[model samples]
Every structure is written in structure tokens, then in C-alpha cells.
Target: MIKLQKNVDCVLFSVPPILLLGPHLAPALLKAYAEDKGFRVVCYDPSPGIYSRLNSKEQEGWPYNNFEEVFKDKALLLEEVNLWLDEVFKYNPKIIGLSTHAWASKFFIEPISNEIRRRAPGVQIITGGPVALDLGIEWKQNGWVDHYVVGDGEEAFLELLSGGTNHPNIDGKIPVPISQEAFRALPEPDFSDSDVEYYKQKAKGNRLYLIGSRGCVFNCSFCNVPAMTQKYRYKDGVEFAREIMNAQERYNTNYIELADSITNAAPNEFRKMCHELIRLKEEKQLDPKIICFFRIRRAQITQEEDFALAAKAGICRLKIGVESGSFDVREHIGKKETNDDIFFSLEMCKKYGIKVNLLLIAGYINETEEMFQENLEFLREIKRRELDEAIEMVVVNELYISRRTPVFDFAKDTGVFDNIDPEDDLARDAWQTQLSNGEMLDPKIRRQRVHSLKKFVSENFVHLKNLLVFAADEKFSAETGS
Candidate 1:
């Protein structure tokens, strides 16, 4: 342990819950690292503080799903911001770190950041988020942010806290990727600070939120994974399973959510993990339903192999990035899964009695009416063949470019974002392609199509319709005004 530059070493803040704060693995891992390094770290979540003001007879269920959207109202945001200001001011720390990943954080963190600057001018405010590396000097000079980190946050944050030099600032963004060995050396999460009961209540049970790994192997063109996690890294199945069992015991939950982009990024390791989990379940008489995001390929989903082992090991649902039905569009975006691959994987999931959530993206850069039609036909084929029966829910989203995705680069290279100049070059909102036919793709149409598909899947899929609530409660508080 070395003497710190300031009294309190680091205060990390998590803002904007996707849904009442399921365990945030990032902060936990980072906190564990700081403790191991002999640093005093305080993990703060502002949701409960923000929740107090919103209490009412009807609004007592205040921190509902998508509750962060309520902050869009300026007055409402200030109410929450004031609460955060009180807590942050109480700490009066020298270093304040904000984590931003979800789209809401772009706007949601602003007011709190503003209040941080106003109250403590001397405090160094750092941010790690999507597009942080690309933020211009003007944006970084806005008083709220002293330095923004890019790639993995742990090393960059530790370096900043230790008063060590970081990467040469690209417009004041300190871009650094932690070494894989260092990442592997991170201690088990220390969630001693967070609201465990709140997480359990939000999960409505003893739901275990565990991370199988970080980073992704594939470079899907429209994916933001590459910018966030620089390379592929994962823990083997046995390691992941032991962690899961330990988390289940810790949280007292049978439902396990592996919060990885692709939990089975490593094939053989995944099999070993699955085998160990199945054996553990049998030995301990445990019934765990594992849910995690996955990337589907024909090789991984064979009849007597990965899918079978995963299903036997309590892999209830696998969220697969189906992307688009059009082979042309998928190929265009560098997604290796073919139409045959999609159906084949679904068949395997069905045979093994494992539910799958098909994650579809609409409107590629070169998307045409025919491309969407191809996707439409794919959905039709699935329904016509009753393959939709195997699916839990089909989440179709209107494609929006995320900053630093390959698609965004293509749009940038084509001068679509030229009006914003080189400064805002990575802004996904600036991505718009002018077709050779002299017409831009209407986003409204794509959005409409996505909504229509969502409705259709909800109403039509036989088994899937019944399992919708278990997948995600989109209407948990739709009319409650909470």
C-alpha cells in the first residue's frame, strides 16, 4: 500500500438502472480489484436515494422497470440530481468515477455530473462509457469531466487513482485495455456495499447475476463490443459453474443470469463447464435455470453435444444474436451465421428443450425493402414450420449505429457524418447513408416493422407467448406512473 494523492482513494458511481439494478458485475469486479491493491473504494448506487422522492400510494413500487426513463423530465431529473448531489457532496472525495454503458447514461449522467462540478470544483471527475474515447476536447472541457477512460475501466481507473501516467490523451480520453493476465487475476466480486435485498426484490426471487466472462471473439460489423472490450477473454465452464453455484448460495436464488455477451465463446471450456454443472446439480440436488446471451453457430449446437450438455446443465434460455434473416445482410455485416445455421441452431435448441430468444436487428447500412422482406420470409418460415414454438421471445430492434462499430466507420468513411466534422465523427446518430438511388432509408419504416414483428411474435408463438413474462416484463409498470 502506498500513500494516496487524496484522503479518500476512489468513489465509483453507478447510475441509470435498466430495471431496478440487477447486480452490476463491473463495479463489483473493480471494487474487488481495488481492495486487493490496498485501496479504499466506495461503491455508490444513487437509485435508492432517487427512489425516496418518487414515493406515493400508487408509486410505492417506485424503482420499476425502465424507471430511468422517468428522468427524461427535467424537473424529475433535478429531483433525483439533488439527491445524488447530497450523497456525492457528503463523500467530498478527490476522485469521482462514473460508469456509463446503456444509452440512457449519456443524458442521465449529465445533471449529476453538473452538480458534482458545481459542488466540488477541485474533485477530479472521470467517466468511462461508450464513445468516451472519441469525445472531443470541447466536450471534455465542459467542467464536469476531467478525464474519460476508454476500453476496460479497471486499469485506467487504478492508474488514475494512483496518480500514474495513462495513455496519451486522444482529445482527453485515456484509452487503455487491461492486460488479460491482470483481468484474470481480479478477485471474486465484493458486493458488500450494494443493496442486495433490493437486487433480490427486483429479481422477485433469489436471482443470481453472475459474469461468465468479458469481451467477445467475433467482430460483427454493427456490434459495439470491440470498442468496449478490446479482445476475447473468458473463463472456462467449470470455473463459471462454481461461481454460479457460489452466487446461488450467496443470493439464495435458483435463477442464474450469466451476464456475458457470449457465454460460450470458448467451445470446449463451455462443454467442460456444462458437464461440471450437471454433475454438481445432481450431487447437490440443485435446480438452477441458467440464462445467458450467446452467439449461435452450427458447430456448437449439435444434437448430442453442446446444446444437450447445456440443457442438461440447466441452461434454460440462450439469447442468440439472430441479427437479420437476410443472408445477404448478415454476410454484409460480417455475421457468419447463415439462414441454415439459424434454423439448425433453433432445431437443436428445440430437441434439447432449451428456449431461445432471437435477437433481430433491422435496417443494415445497405438494407433494402427486399432485405427486410427476406427477414419477413424468415419469420414466416419459422412460424410456418412451427419453429417459433421453440423460441421464448423475438426481440426485434430498429438498427441504430453505435459509436465505433464497423458500420459507423463505413458511414463515416462515406462522409455521412461529415457535417459534424472530425470531432463528432463517432456519433452513431450522425450515421446516415445516401443510397445510389438518391433516397435515404426511412427510420420510421424500420421502427414500424420492428414493432409489428414484436407484436406478431407476442401474439403468435404458442409456447413463447406463455413464457414472455419470464423472458422480460416490458409492461411491469406501464400504466402505474411510477
Candidate 2:
């Protein structure tokens, strides 16, 4: 169903609606791959369009409960859709690439695709990203896409650009590998995008994001990185330093957000990359600040020197995926790091003046009231420390069990299709879990606390309302001697 050879082999890559500062690096990387071989590559990003409308005055829906909520204002939705489709039609692309990173994006995909199909019935539609790869072929049958690159798309996309029709498929999905030759030739994303002015307005020329590696070394139960990439593949230290330099020089960017699943893979190599960046910074080649995702294994956490070096290299932020506060729950999720190790890592970041963001999860598979309280206490403990700007944020998100994750496997092992309905959209929310005993675990209590708890975590013990409320309440009760 691919319209591969429509006209001059132009590839139109686009990221779907929803906001995240700017366009993702996926399409840019695909553009780089295709352009290197002298193919015509075009782009159509919906982020600016989406952000403009959402932030516009008199916009009917400011805070949407769901995608349907925004669509409820039919006039607003249609206006945005028209603007988006106009951009798409500009290229008259033979092939179209859609970004499928978040499941929430599926909402916009349906409406957008319906419109695109109406406009260009013969266009070859391709989908790739985290969810597309994680769910595999079944994802393609969602009545939207005709083709999919269910793996690292850099090389596979290049092959497709070179006029190969037969895709690599296993169980009705194409999961192609980046050949060793292609791996060596992979280039940093081409960021001469149309949204440079938009990015500048958003973050003052610092909204750019890049990925040094793909896949995580740790396949946590709830994570989809391992299934998406199959295994960890990386760019070496020198190549990574070059990428940092290029992105900064070309984009005039101050902050570079590393979008790796876990940035510090293969410890020595990560250290080497940091040293290279430090050397580059000292030489005044590129003095760019960075934010990266990291894990807290013993080897990584115990080594303060590694983190200190990263701080010297200008890594300002580290987002740690600390799934749960309860050690038992954490171990169940295959997180081997202990509470002490996590604290030690935070202390090291603090020592080096690097800000930390602990990513927590609530309403996990089989989570109880007690465990949720433990999460609150964990947030409280972090607040109590008063590290004085060492902690940037604490994002306590709902745990959604996506395809190819251990949590999804657990759901299948428990009931498979008998109790859990894969096609049912409501069941897919992180708010619901189907227990093996046929009982359902819903996020009723969890949802009730999400707003207030998020508020408390963000503003508590800070210069805001309810300042140190936990400690203040404790002190007041103790002083009363009741």
C-alpha cells in the first residue's frame, strides 16, 4: 500500500499534534539520512500550529480533560486542522512520515489522518516512534497507517529512500536493523528547521533536543525502551562530542536536552564522553548546557567522580527514573538500586551543582494505599532535605502499561485476552489494571490526590503557599502535647 515512487522520491516528515517545546529529533534524523544520499526531504511539524492555537486568546478549551474535550469546540479544532493540512499539502509529498512517540498522540492521529487521506489518497503513510515499535503490526491495523518502520528508522528509512519496496517484516511488522556500515555513517539530526524562531521564543534558543544513543541498558518492567530498540546501541565519545558541537554551532543553542532512554550507558564510555565535552568546553569550542536522563545503579551511583565530571562538562539537569518509593515495589519492577544509593546519587549531583528531578510513579500494577503513602513520604523527605535549588522537579506520573513491557507481559500471563481487552481504549489508561483474580484495580483514590499532591510536591517547603507544611504540622502537633 506504499506510494513509494510517486514523484522524484520526496519524503515528508511530520510530528503529530501536542506540545513539547518544539519538533522532535526523529524526523530531523530521517531528513539527515535521506538528504545525505541526495534525496528530496520535506518537513511539516504541527507543534507550532498546535501551540499557537492552544495559547491563543479566546481559545475555547484551555485545559482539556481529553482530546475529545478540545474537539468539543468544533470550530477551534477545525481551524487548527485546516492550518495543519494546508502545511501538509504544501509539499505534495510522495511519502509521509508521522511521529508516534506518545499514546496520547493517537487522538490527533485519527483526525489528522482522516483529513490527510481525504487530501492525498495516494500518499504512502509511514509511522514510527516508541509506541509504533512497541505495539508492532497490530499498531498498523489501527486503520490509519499503511507502512511502519518499527525499529531504529535511520538506516531502514534510508533503504526505503533508496527504492527498496520489500520491507523487513516479522509477524506482520517491519523491524529492520541498522547495519554495521549504516551505524558508522549515522549523522546528527539536521536542525535547519522552519521553527527556529518559534524555538527562540519558547526557550530563547535553548529548546533543541538531541539523542546520543538509543535504548536503555536496563529493561525495567514498565519501560518500553528495550522492546523499541531491541538492545542498546550508541555513538562513541568523539562522535557524541562532535554532535554536541555541531548542534550548538548550527542552532546557536544554549541548552541541549539529551533524549536518550538512559544517557549514561557503558559507564567508561559515558565518562569519556563527559571528559570530551569538558575538554571541548575548556577549548571554547562549544559551551552548551545539557539535561540528560540517567539511572542509579551501584556502579553509577557510588562513583561521585563521574557525576562531578559530568557537572564540569555542563550537564545541568539529570532526570532519574525512580519508579517507586517502596523498595519492595521497586524490586518488583526490576529496579536494583536501593534508597541509600539513590540518596547518594542525589547528594553527588548536589555536590556538583547539578539539578535533579526524581521521576516517580503512582497507581502501578497491584499498588495499594500504603505504597502510595510511601510515595508521598518519599516526596516529603526530599522536600525536607532543603537542598537549596539542587532539586529542580519531582514528576509523579501515572503508570501506564504499554506493549512489550514486562508489565504488559504480566497482564498477559495473568489473564491474556480473557480479562484484559487489548482493543478497549479505557483499559489502556494507567488508571486501570486487570488483576489475575478478575478484580480490577482503578486509580480512583490516586486521581483524587494527583492535583493536590503534585501541588504539594512542587511548592512544599519552598517560597510559596504551604511552605514546609509537613514539618510545620508535625511541630505544631508535638508542641501541643496532645
Candidate 3:
């Protein structure tokens, strides 16, 4: 017998994928709404188990063994969903909000949305996140989602929860189409009542995620940032430092993952922030590992001083969006980069002993096989060098074409995408068809190419590690006779 709580105004349920571990946008937005409407809010995240598996803490009572193992099986996902449904039923709030992002839409949104609808027909179901904006009309047509909030959700969500019309104004402190005021107003994310002990146990070591800034200035063709109208806004440097120190004191956090799209977009602002961080570290004797994502212009990385400062500030890992190896493809997609810039940036990061995660896309409009092979060969060369040195280099593939990105527009104009429905399942299925017969390589061929690359990486990873070590430590040359 399930008892319903009328006192509960809204319940926020966040379903994030295992691969992405960071502060969620929807949860933060709803937190603001809860504060505004005086509604009791609760967040249901399956991410604890996901994080446990990814961080290899599942051996202690969690279900999955590792990230790879958990993500490979759909049964595990179904089991997790059942557990989530049980938890949601226990809360039994009036309004249910489903949070989604692009990466986890297919795996997390579809199955859970259907189940929630079947069981809890009385509860109003709303979906918000990146996919909400990208596929809002499609979702609305499906009847699974009662309302969709596009752009920053804080204002729109509050109105909806207060029984306002479903389609509310997109104006408020937060920007509708790229304003920094809204980002500035974002209160410190409410993680106080969350299952801190559970996450801590999963983390195993000290771990913290910090968002020092919001939005991105660059409009990379494959990225969804531009469409979100994310304006670049920085939290006060001093305030950010205080948050870091507070987290350190509370959680004994040894690693800080900066959850910004580009950490160094405003070089001077970031430098100031880094200076404060360094001061805190030196004065307080606080030592924490740092990892961040950034888009490196050739000019920025070539400056030895910049790389040195980043290394000194404890930035051990850096992710760069090197979408393609071909200069022509880069220009075609509106990514302003030359081949020289890409190689230089990689070498500089290598020289600074920073781990590099290079993101590559395959199914771009008008992508040539020769271009892909060139990218593959470049990765092979990097792997070969890693055999001699002790630095880490990873190459990940991008398969999904984001609706808001220029690539989608290109696909539409080029007749690659004949039927572009916004519904998640239908659009995904339609995209698969395009992937099969479109200008890019056939689906079968793409799978074969990916499998071959994976095999090559698996066999040569050990050598790559050795090379990384060699690069970092001079003594490796004498020992390895390279």
C-alpha cells in the first residue's frame, strides 16, 4: 500500500548516465524553483551506483563491477530503473520532473518515462534538460511529457509548479538567449541533504566537483552550448575559492573537477581565479588534484607561460575538442582551427605532463574516409609516442548529431536528414537511417572502423603508457634503449 504525501509540492528526479559525473543543470534549476514556491523538493539520482561502478567501488556492496561492465548490459539498467521507481513511489509527490541530457536521453529517458507514466498516472510528468530544448515539440506530441521547458529552467519551472500556464515567458534573471545575469543569480547548488555518505563511500578518495563559471563563447559546430544560449558568466573569484575551501574542510576532498565548458575562456579571469587557488593551497597547505575541459587555440597553448601556470595550479588532466584532423573539414563545420594548431596544442600539453583527452567526431556532414583515416593515423602516432613516454592520450568518438548544432543544419541542407522528427525515439531511429545511407560511412562500416580502432588501442595502450612515463621522466630513455 503506497501512501501519498500532499505536503510534497514537487519531486525532482535526475537520471544521469554513468559516463558523465558532474553537477546536473536540471537539479540546480529546480532547486531554485523549490526555494521560490516553498515546495518540498527531493532528487532521485541513480548516479550513486553509476559512480561506484565507474570509480571501481562496486566491490563493496554495489551491483556492478566497473563502468564498462555496467554500461554494456541493458538488464543492469532495467534493474536500476526498477529500484528508482520504488524510491519514487515511496516519496509519492504531486509533481514529477524527469531530468535528461543528450548523452543519456535514449538509455535513461525513454524507459523510465514509460514506466513512470504507467504506474503513476496521477502525477504530472515534466521533462527538462538539453534534450528538452532539442526535442521539445516531439516530446510534447508523444504525450509522455506534459510540458517542456526550454533554455534556463529556473523561472519557467517555478511558474509551472505554481499552476501557471505550461508555456510561460522565458524571461527573468536567467538569460533567455544568452544573458549572464541568470547564471550569476544561480545559488550555490543544494547538496546538503543529499546522500553524502553514499557518494563519499563510492568516491573512495576525496572528490569534489566545482562550477566556477557558466556558458561558452565559442560556437563549435558539433557542440550544443551555442544553442542553449549559454552566456559566459564567472562566479566571483573569491567566492569560488571560499566554496573550494569549504568543500575541502567538509569532505576532505583531494580532487576538484571544474565543471565549466571551458575553464580558460577568459584568460585573465581564469588566471585571477588560479592565483587565488594557488594562494589557498600554499597558505592553507591544501593540496587537491584538478581536472578541467578547455578548447585550446594554437596561440594559447604555444605560450609556455600559460601551460606552466596551468601545471603549477594542479591541472593534471585537460580535455580538448579536436573534432577533425583535416583542416578543410574543420572549416566546413565552422570550427576555426588549423592542423598546425591542433598538433601544437597536443605537443604542448604533452610537454607539460598534462593528460590529454581528445574528442573526435565521425558522422559529420561531408566527412571523407580519407579524413577519418588521417585522424586515426594521427591517434596511432600519438599512441606510438606514448609507448616511449609516461603521458596519457585518449581519443573518444562522437556518433550522435545534436539538433542545435550546425552539423544538423548542414545535414538538413545537404538532404542527409530527410525526416528530422524531434521525438526522441523517432528522431534517433531517423538518424540511424541517415547514418546508414548518408554521405558519411555506412553504419556497418562505421561499426567495423570503431571496432578496429578499439582493438588497436587495447593492444597498444600499455606501450602508450610506457611512452608517457618516458616523456615525463628522462631516466626512461636509458632503461628502454629507445
Model number with the top lDDT: 1
Candidate 3 has an lDDT of 0.61
**Once superposed on the true structure, which residue ranges of model 2 sit more than 4 Å away at CA?**
1-8, 18-20, 55-65, 73-79, 134-143, 169-174, 179-181, 299-302, 415-419, 430-441, 448-456, 459-482
- Please say which candidate is ahead in TM-score: 1 or 3: 1
TM-score list, all predictions: 0.84, 0.83, 0.75
lDDT of 2 by residue, 96-184 (tens): 77766666666666666667788889876677776675443654677577766777776666666665645563222535556545665
Off by over 4 Å in 1: 1-8, 51-76, 89-92, 134-139, 167-174, 299-303, 413-440, 465-482
CA shift of 289, model 1, Å? 2.3
Superposed on all Cα atoms, the candidates' RMSDs to the truth, in angstroms, are 5.3, 6.9, 7.8
TM-score of 2: 0.83
Q: What range of 10 consecutive residues in model 3 has the weakest lDDT sum?
A: 467-476
For each predicted model, how many residue pairs clash, with residues at least 3 apart or on different chains? 3, 0, 16
Q: List model 3 lDDT by residue over 316-397, tens digit each.
A: 7777767666666677767776666766666767777777655555544455666667766766776655521423544435
Computed on alpha carbons, the lDDT of every model, listed in order, comes to: 0.68, 0.66, 0.61
Native-referenced Cα lDDT, model 1? 0.68
